[model samples]
Target: MSAKIQSSNKKGLFTKFLDVIEVVGNKLPHPVTLFAIFSLAVVIISAMAAAAGTTVDFDRVDMATGETELTTVVAISLLTAEGIRRIFSEAVTNFTGFAPLGTVLVAMLGVGVAEGTGLVQAALRKLVLATPKKLITAVVIFAGIMSNVASDAGYVVLVPLGALIFLSFGRHPLAGLAAAFAGVSGGFSANLIVGTIDPLLGGISQQAAQMYSPGYTVDPTANWYFMIVSTFVITIIGTIITEKIVEPRLGAYTGGEKASIEKVSDHETKGLKWAGISLLGLLLVMLALTLPANAVLRSDSGSLMSGSAFMAGLVPIIALFFLVPGIAYGMAAGTVKSDKDIAGFMGKAMSTMGGYLVLAFVASQFVAYFNWSNLGTILAVKGADVLQATGMTGIPMLIGFILVSGFINLFIGSASAKWAIMAPIFVPMLMRLGYSPEFTQIAYRIGDSTTNIISPLMSYFAVIIAFAQKYDKKTGIGTLISTMIPYSLVFLAAWIILFVAWFALGLPLGPGAYIRL
Candidate 1:
């Protein structure tokens, strides 16, 4: 009785804490407004910094001479007459020139088609249903992780389907929901294929990196190798937590209603077969283009990974990878009757990007203002000096950064938005400490992905709670967070361990992306 009372008291306190978090999160300004405010603040700060004669000196590699040269950066006040005119003139170009804007829009166009044709959803359903009952949990979790390829489809389809699958199997429905939710939200950054996020985050990182190394480029595949490895690691860890911890805690399901698991129809199966064949053909064609010593896709030095034509054209290639398969599936499944249908599907995909486009506009201005002021460079140099002074220049510092990223995630939901605000500061600062921007990005992702499931501020958290309430009416924010906290904690630990091991072994984070400069 005493133990039960203690548990209840603890639950009550946690509930209150979450209530406070939700309240505080609600009071924050919209991300676009926040960026607008940040841009104004940057302008004002630049003036003050310039008046104070703030400057920092650092050694920069001179690309022309291939020699390290001492460089001094001084704050350029945006309040100057020239600065104000430049800002007014550059406003239109800033939005147009933002790196992430075009890349994300292009990638989503293809993803939207695949999603519109029901190919992604059918594939997810097929994977979950085809797995043997004993291995169903792992398959559901894996499917959810991969479903990120189509954005929010995993949350809308797989979360509820997981509940039905478990309930049909005489297991706890809530456990299934938790498992799928863990994979989709908590494992957001781990994927076998490059998703839209790769380009979005990479572009932001590249912009940040250029604040220090003017010509440096961070590719969309910067974190690909680490992400591929993390996919399997998260799958195995997620499966263990679901079966051993989440399921046992949920116990037997005494829910009133029983629903049948939906099986894929004959047309969907035909669509899958055609999609697979098209994808295989696409891969073979790519191999033919890339495998030869004098291949067209190779770089000037015959390298496939660096400065290659293939790397430069990767965004369109990814689009074709999805578009071709999507069209094949659509035709096979009778979802596409004409070329007009395909056009409509693509247009539909682009339509959802209205919010992102608005957010990107403000964010671009903020970044542009920061770069013009030279404040980012000064701050990075000062931050690196401070870290060097304190002797926290290695793994410990990286871990601390991950923790800070995760903590920040609780207040901001959009990954790109948080990264936009952070990349300018953290990316350059960590780069000064001898860490590559790619490595800093990987650390940030690990933190961002792990905390997503537990954050009330996550855009999809309310949606997950709604899905849960269908299974158990009493389900709320606290209930969902309680169930998901285990996955969050375990994933964070496992990823940090993986990161430490990867660091110790000196493995590359991705193609041409190393741990140090």
Candidate 2:
């Protein structure tokens, strides 16, 4: 009886804590408040670091180089007006030239159009509906993990879709959303399919890790084999956690106001078919451009997969794929007419992103400030020293690194940036301790992706708030945060444990690769 009482007391405290979190989250303001808070927080962190004589290595290197020469790189200071002019003149020589800006923008245009069209939502609905009931939870989670490549696609599409699918099945919608978000946001590193982020981040990781190993070659798919398996692991774990812990607490759909099923008439269905045909045609054309050895889509080289213009321009291509099909579908389906209507759709899409835009603007500045200050580097180096001193080889070091990475993620929201700060220190440290850069990278990804579900600083936090609001008007950052915290905690624990087991068994992280050096 005493033991049961103690358990009840513990449960009571946890419930009270959740309630407090919900209350605090609800009280927080929207865009302006978030902006101010995040901005001030970054400023404060920067100042404190500066005051403590902190400096970060904000150096740029050519990761493509297979050089093994070790070097120490650190950020100096931001340029003033004269320095800005000097920077502009030397742009061509700069490693991080403005070339990427154009690529990113051009790609986003295509994405904007597709997201404006109802195609993404319609397809997701059909997918969720078609999945077997038993597989629904896992499917939702898996879909979330794969959606990362699309940027905000998972937050905008899958999260809400998960809730709707659950409601349709007479389960708690929030629980379903949690399951999907956990998979998408937290297990983002564990995609069963290929994604664009692989090459981009791999490039950065390669550059950073090379500080320790001049000959280090970080494969774009270094973590792919493990991620494929982890996809299922996360899906199952997410499903079980949601159904077991989350749903029971929420009780029922008594929260009211479920989104009504769209009554797609025969005409609408035909329009969808035509839209699908148009999309297929676009894809076929894209494939043709890709399939040919000497194709226009190929980069300066004749390669079409990686080095090709088509693959390198994937983000833009994806955006275009969505825009063209969505526009065609809209016209054929009679959901759109005239240039004005199309423009309106695009305009509406942009408007919906106002909050995100605000968040991103603030986040970019914060990232810039932190990078400029070089505190991340100092912290990471010190951390590497601590890890090195432990002399824990193999799994223990990997686990410790993952935990450290998780801690770092709390401070720096951008995965690439955090990895940039981390790779130089941990990669070299692990190398000396007899661990591989690939293993360090994988462990870092696990920690980085999992905590995104709960981090308020993530650019997508506001996007998730919008998703939650669709279910309950009362849903705010606090509600979303509180709801998803369970997922973040559970996923972090379960994933770390699984990673350790994989390490213990001395399983290869990928084909022909070992976790230990």
Tell me, by lDDT, which candidate is best: 1
Tens digit of lDDT per residue, candidate 2, span 1-517? 9999999897677667656644554555554454456545555665565455554332223435633343454433333454346434643433332122233344455555555666556666666777898888888888888776555688877887788888888787877888878877888888865454665456555554554444455655567778888887888888887878777877877777565555455655665787789889998998888777777898667765445566555556656766787787677767777877777766765666555444444434433443444543555555656665776555666777788888666555767656644565566556655566777788888889877877666667877777667667787655676677777888888888878787778777764456865
Q: Report the Cα lDDT for residue 153, model 2.
A: 80
**Ten-residue segment with the worst summed lDDT in candidate 2?**
93-102
Q: What's each prediction's TM-score?
A: 0.98, 0.69
Instruction: In candidate 1, list every pair of residues with a backbone clash.
Output: none
lDDT tens digits, residues 1-517, model 1?
Answer: 9999999999899999999889999999999999999999999999999999999999885534556778899999999999999899999999999999989888887888898899988988888787899999888888888888777789998999988888888899999999999989998999998888888899999999999888788888998899899999999999999999999989888879697977899999999999999999999999999999889999989999878999887888888888999999999999999999899999998888889999999999999999999989989999999999999989999999999999889889999999999999988899888788999999999999999999999998999899889889999988899999999999999999999999999999988899888
Residue 279 in candidate 1, Cα distance off native in Å: 1.0
* Candidate 2 runs further than 4 Å off: 1-104, 192-227, 248-259, 265-268, 292-311, 336-389, 408-441, 455-486, 497-517
The 0-to-1 C-alpha lDDT of every candidate, in the order given, reads 0.91, 0.66
Global Cα RMSD, each model: 1.2, 6.4
